[model samples]
Target: MTVQTIPAPAAPLRVTPASPLFLREDEIRRGIELLYFGYTAMIRGADAILEAQGLGRAHHRALYFIARQPGLSVGELIGLLGITKQSLGRVLTELQARALVEQQVGTADRRQRLLRLTKAGAALEARLFGELERSMARAYGEAGQQAVTGFWAVLMGLVPPDDRPRVEALQA
Candidate 1:
């Protein structure tokens, strides 16, 4: 039999005084602006890459999420992407035609069509998404410690508090 090891948890520490930070309004505004700037640059890069392949962001989003949860139903993908049915249909058609994604009927629910990535699709997503991830990481690193952590906090706040549990569960 194979053995497994798990690390023990550390004991809780007592409260301590932290460094004081004077965050001015202008500085906070700049922080928000940097968030916008960073997002725009990242999107521009991803758009160019997708355009080169004659695909769009919608396609990228669809492929990216579906890859994470293979066999996702059309309805489920619709919910995740939060796009109009017509818009999604267009992208799904293109993906299906290219054999990047395949749709199969749900076993119990005949009306539902489940989507999954083919080997080629997963490979393509990895190549494209790898670039996006690296670029984003570099950009955030350049933004320094405060902006990086602050930006994460801001983005996390964008999601509703009620939905946080659901989001955390999914990531878990």
Candidate 2:
């Protein structure tokens, strides 16, 4: 007997907001500009320090997440980074070559490779985090408690729904 297969329907189009809640185009544009500048400034704050070590944003992010969740597996790091395995591999290779990160076989699963920051890595991460904290502290202080909370909410909301669980797990 021959079997027939049905194709899946295409996803529905996204709806644009029509109410007062929608932001003006100019306002939206300004918000985008602000985000760009804010991110640039935030990275610049740590760039000098990272530059001294010949590292970049990818290295910093890997260190940050590994420091945050010690013993995180290589697979988990790749997922959390949202980067290709090749990209992550380069970063991990650099970090490992610099003696900043250590990887060991997982106790529960021998096939899994667990990662941790070495003492040097922790120190570097702390310094990078300190630079970030200086700027973040000032921003949060100026923004006030409510704004700070709102900022976190907005940032969290920007994360993909599918990745929220992984983010929440890290937060916990």
Candidate 3:
């Protein structure tokens, strides 16, 4: 005798009108407005901390991520950030000119350069951590654990599967 088994039904996803995704046209418009406001406020907060140090978000991203994983290749950074080659080149030039980053010739590949944060760059990263962590902590405190987890889940959903490991490695 042969037996056949049926797969179980998938669980339903929970979403609300306030969620930018499932909302109707009018609701989506309102949600977009809120998102714009929130993003603007967050950038403003970040800028306030960054401006004093003469560093902007782009430099901050490079410094922080490079410090997180020293010796990460330029190719790896470009892949993780998903920016155009020209845009990344400009940022790299700025960082290198400032002596915040150093490029070492790849051991195996002569043409390839591996990037690392210089001592100054690592110090800047360590300094920025306090302010960044405080801001994020305050946001999490206001949002609560469930909201924070949900927000992370929504963000992770936006990323492709193959890119998830790179993001997770940074988090680690």
Top-TM-score structure, candidate number = 2
Winner of 1 and 2 under TM-score? 2
2 against 3, candidate with superior TM-score = 2
Candidate 2 CA-lDDT value: 0.83
Off by over 4 Å in 1: 1-28, 140-150
RMSD of 2: 15.1
Give the per-residue lDDT digits (tens) of candidate 2, residues 10-115. 4322323335754778667766786899888888889999999999999999999999999999988998888999999999999999999999999999999899
List, residue by residue over 63-100, the lDDT tens digit for candidate 3: 77788888888888888777877888898999899898
Evaluate all candidate structures by whole-model CA lDDT and list the values in order.
0.76, 0.83, 0.73
Candidate with better TM-score, 1 vs 3 = 1
lDDT of 2 at 74: 90
- How far out, in Å, is residue 10 in model 1? 26
Q: Which portions of model 3 miss their true places by more than 4 Å? A: 1-22, 25-31
Query: How close to the true structure is residue 107 of candidate 1, measured as C-alpha lDDT?
Result: 97
What TM-score does candidate 3 reach? 0.71
Sort the candidates on lDDT, descending order.
2, 1, 3
Question: Against the correct fold, how does model 1 do in TM-score?
Answer: 0.74
lDDT of 1: 0.76
